[model samples]
Target: MRNVSIDELDDTPRVVVAIGTDYAHGHLLARHTHRRAQLLYGATGVMQVSTHDGSWVVPPQRAVWIPAGVAHEVLMLGVSTRSLYIEPEAVDLGRQCQVIDVSPLMRHLLMEAVEAPLNYDEAGRDAVLMDLLLHELARSTHLPLHIPLPVEPRLLGLCQAFVQQPNAHQSPRQWADQLHISLRTFNRLFRQQTGLSFSQWRQQACVVLALARLATGTPVTRIALDCGYESPAAFSTMFRRILGQAPSVWLAATNS
Candidate 1:
């Protein structure tokens, strides 16, 4: 399935089937859609998935569930990926994209799935495997791994710029001044456009950026300073606040 189009998988009769492959760093798959919903999982790297509605970050050992017929593009960072295409009618997942943590059982199930024939036997071991896989997927935990993009063009530009060089110290007043809008107006428009306040958006962006950096074995201290935090302690504090644990503990659990 290395070079096969996802459309071809749509014709597969199985309720769920997988295509396992890997991508080099910085590889981009331009926007596309499939007839079946997809679980794009990366066992060893990060992926940034984007659609017209929003963008999501899938850190190592996790996956993103994309509903059928949504146009999305994926940028892979040296990932060992396993893609699952499922008949939406066969599953109860809602019609939205979500990031889910792949458990040990789910991980093994995915790897095993790619090894089975596309037209797998429905009354044999293959059926049981796929059934268990679907069960695990439906029960996986959702992560706060998404950063919604703004609909307003001017605000969109600002959001893109900030992502490129995020700094924790940049104040809302400074952003308002740069945009030549009053602080009150900026705050209101930002919330209206992105459904989040300036401060909230900044924190979300920082956490998303930090994930990729941390996955590459970068030190937490350096990641903090690079993201414009005053110190490692400050960065860890924020990281724990947003993610509910220190970076080391959080990442170890995910990777394990």
Candidate 2:
């Protein structure tokens, strides 16, 4: 795992740190929780952060707001990553966990925040800068891509299997075979329980897997192949269709 220690940060009521990397292995950070609420931004790369309730894939143009005290893991896909972590008490508007769009003002302010020198002054221009940063966060948009996972042991077991092997491409029939259920019954139950068809659920699983790999800087071609795509071009096309941009362009426009 590629790691960066964030200890010894300045003594502001909230902490802000900037992280940028270009490592490729499909895993960037581990599962951990912090006392502070965290805002995870990926200026580049697609990132996946999962909590017990759901998994979130944060695009380069967006950030994830993790409420203080929630335990979650971070997964990085291919492309470079420039992230900013903010303390929860730093901002009052975004107190809950969510994924929100990072505006240009917010992005610029974050860059400035990270570049600002640490100090202990009680009042000054620095204090004003901090307040502006908090305001920018409130103006950001919230995007919907949280993948809520089922809590049942049986369902979770299946989810774990798929996460371990994203390219499995198993059909409901195959899933039924493994679970010792009739294909028709499995299909009915899966939709009834998850509000998604077997294929839809699998696509969501695949996308999250793709997000994790992309955040780690895995090659688009290799990720596509690993995720069972026939070719990188095909994968990019699909990614653009779904994400509104080609992978490389998305990466470039999001962060730096």
Candidate 3:
């Protein structure tokens, strides 16, 4: 139900419980875990979700699938959220957290879901809607919005620092030197730990960080320079290459 806490109804017999909540700008929900799987959709603004393993940025009109019992924290940027807490046995989105694309139909369904009763009838329109929503979620496309973190203390510190002040020009050799390891060893270890090459992860970090600012109406030129790009054109090229559209175009679509 609207503006309700899931904890109040966590034991409800329904297979799925929906809730809608709004957060002020720059609100943070500290680390917490849930007994049920969650499909957290941002109807507006951006969401930054972090777990022990990685971080995900969910832009407007997108959602993140958080598996049951996964401890995570969320930072909401002017966000209004529609969340689905599903019984673990009712669906298996996946074991890992994911940022998924929400179709227009799915978006409408999520808004409608938050209006359904906590104890919605099992053999009625609400049940049918919930079933359709689950089907839509299963077919949703996963996005490359996740930045996996390394477990090693030294490398993890470096990764965390870079995320705070991302720079496109940061070189792998620099990180290797800081870790006091040879470039060869760093490359191998970086891939093994994060499942991506150093260069690939660097680009991803820059793009994901840019998205948070972009959602707040930051200008492209400013964001480009902040991300260490030489020019807005250069930044847009990289943004398009990774996300398939220029930053402005993508933001427009997300807001539309």
Candidate 4:
């Protein structure tokens, strides 16, 4: 159903409910939770999803899977979303949130599903389509768009600050000194808490942050400088290394 709130139909007998909603640029959906797992697809624009654990940048044509009951917030940028809310028992997409690619077939299926009735006939063509949608979701490839947050209070504070003003040249030694810990200890603790080495996590954070600006037609050179890269070429190199496409190429795909 287009533009309908899921809360109003949360008790529908169907295992899955699909809805589409459009948002103005830079709209923020404050922290909330759902009883059903959600496949939140961005048919256009970008989405920034955050939870206690970390944040994810969902690029255009991609989606983020939010497990049931995970309190999260979304910052939508010129987004038109197609969301599937599925009963927890009906799917096993793991307990963690993930960003996943939307195949062409799955994209068309999502468009179709959102147009189906809230209580689509279980024995009809819509039922078959919903089944196919679930299958597509189960087999979808997860993307490396998540930036996990560290839990240690001191370290978490530093990490949070870095995310606000990401600098590629920021070193672990600097963070360690601020925390009054040895570099070795900081590195070990960072990896243990976030499952990513300091450098890897920093790069991921820069890319994800850059994506939000990139969506709004920000130039690569401007984003590079803002992200603390010395040159757009250097920034594009790292962006390609992490996302497998140069910033311009990715932007073209997003705009297309």
Candidate 5:
């Protein structure tokens, strides 16, 4: 027999339970851990999930899967969340956090799942609905919304500074000089530490930060300037290139 409960009390082959919650703008759920793997859907607004490994941004109509026992924190940018708690044995969603697009069907199913009883019946409609939910989550596309952070002390310092003031106009050479290192050393060590080239890492940082700001009703024109893009079109171009959707289109869709 299968089982479903927000709390794990057995080693069942199929277990999934859900809960619905809302958060006001700028709400932050401090670092925490859960016994069950979680699939959190941002039915409205946007969400930012961070772990020591990396950070992921979930825009509206998107969701994030966090593996069981991984420590994480979620920052809500005016989003309502429908969170599914699954027994680790029930799914192999990898050992990392992932942001994924929510299909229209999956979106509706999540809303329906949240209203389900604490322990859903295995032979009922809720079971079928839960099965479909798991299938959709496993098949969802993984988005490119992650920014992996470095662990080296000096590089970590530089990364922190860069994130604080993301200037697209700033070059790797300039950053290297700030750290008193040669451009060649900076290039090599940056990739070694962050698993991405300096330019690539900077772009990821910019996009992540830009998404958070955009979620709060900031205009593309102003955000571009703040993030140090030369022009709105340039910013949009990079946003589309990296995220596969224009800023205006994404912001509009999320708000609608």
Candidate 6:
């Protein structure tokens, strides 16, 4: 792992800047670290950030945290990312970084930071605004949008297939047979690896897909069917139970 140290600038705040155009390729091409903590969010595309313990896929609505000195990398699926780079000493965030939800205000502050002049003058108003921005950012709630990946080859393959084709109407028994395992054995494996039962995992996966589709203006009936729900009512019941809001409400909240 390579570490990039940023020296204090005489005019601008002593923030070392390391910009990654496509963080996925940057991480793939080189596995490195830096003194600055990173708040990685996509301006348009999505990316996945993986640490030793877990991995998180960051869609446009989420951001992943990379603590200073943590040797982690990203897998970007697209381009034009607006990653925010912050110095550890300058910001008062707790040690050990993790993926955090980015609020609209935080997003605006970050874009403001990018546009702010990089002068070394400590007396500039940008410093005050940046500090306030960081404080506000620390209060944001993180959503579990990042799906964790399992190491077991059988489990991993099964999960990948499920995520790629979430609407597949395969029964647990069928999946167990396909995996050359008994129903009981396969159920145990799912609990062991994902800490969720087969049905629970499938439901969550289906809801994840449904949420994304709904955000894109997909009809509830269509999304419910596409996500393997018997009907929109069943999907709505499940959705309301898990999210505490209906599909329309959730979509409206996000869009608003």
Writing each residue's lDDT as its tens digit, candidate 1 over 1-256 gives 4545666667777788788887889999999988889999998888999987678889988999999889999999989898888888877677768889888899998888888887889999989998998889888898887787888787788788888898998888997898899999999988888788888888988998899888878999999999999899999998898889899998798667
Name the best candidate (by TM-score).
3
* TM, every model: 0.92, 0.67, 0.98, 0.98, 0.91, 0.68
lDDT of 4 at 83: 99
What pairs collide in candidate 5? none
- Scored against the true structure, residue 248 in model 6 reaches a CA lDDT of 78
- Candidate 2: where is the Cα deviation over 4 Å? 1-30, 42-48, 57-62, 75-97, 117-123, 143-147, 181-197, 212-221, 230-237, 252-256
For TM-score, candidate 2 versus 3, the one ahead is 3
When 4 and 5 are scored with TM-score, the better candidate is: 4
| C-alpha RMSD (angstroms) for model 3 | 0.8
Better of 4 and 5 by lDDT: 4
Q: What lDDT score is found at residue 7 in candidate 4?
A: 97
Clashing pairs in 4: none
Q: How many residue pairs clash in model 1? A: 0
Alpha-carbon lDDT of model 6: 0.64
Model 2 lDDT per residue over 15-82, tens place? 55554446573775777776656667666667778878767888766788887778788777654554
- What is candidate 4's lDDT per residue for 1-256, written digit by digit as tens? 9999989999999999999999999999999999999999999989999999999999999999999999999999999999999999998989889999999999999999999988899999999999999999999999889999988898899889988988999999999999889999989999999999999999999998898788878899999999889999999999999999999998897777
lDDT of 4 at 72: 98
lDDT score at residue 209, model 4, on the 0-100 scale:
88
Q: State the lDDT of candidate 5 residue by residue for 1-256, as single tens digits.
A: 1223344533444588677778888899899888889998887888989998878888887889999999999989888888888888877879989888888899899989878765678899999999998898888898878888888888788787877788888888987898899999989998998889988888888898888788877789998999888899999998898888999888887777
Candidate 1 Cα deviation (angstroms), residue 121: 1.0
* Model 5 CA lDDT for position 203: 84
Tens-digit lDDT track for model 3 on 32-136? 999999999999999999999999999999999999999999999999999999999888878889999999999999999989888899999999999999999
- Taken over the whole model, the C-alpha lDDT of each candidate is 0.86, 0.67, 0.93, 0.94, 0.84, 0.64
* Candidate 6 residue lDDT tens string, 1-256: 0122233322234452423343443344235676677777665455656665445555555677778777776666543455556777756555544657778887776666655555524567777666766686678676644455567887788778877777637789987998898999988987888777777777666665565556446799988887777988888988787567788787776555
Q: What lDDT is obtained when candidate 3 is compared to the true structure?
A: 0.93
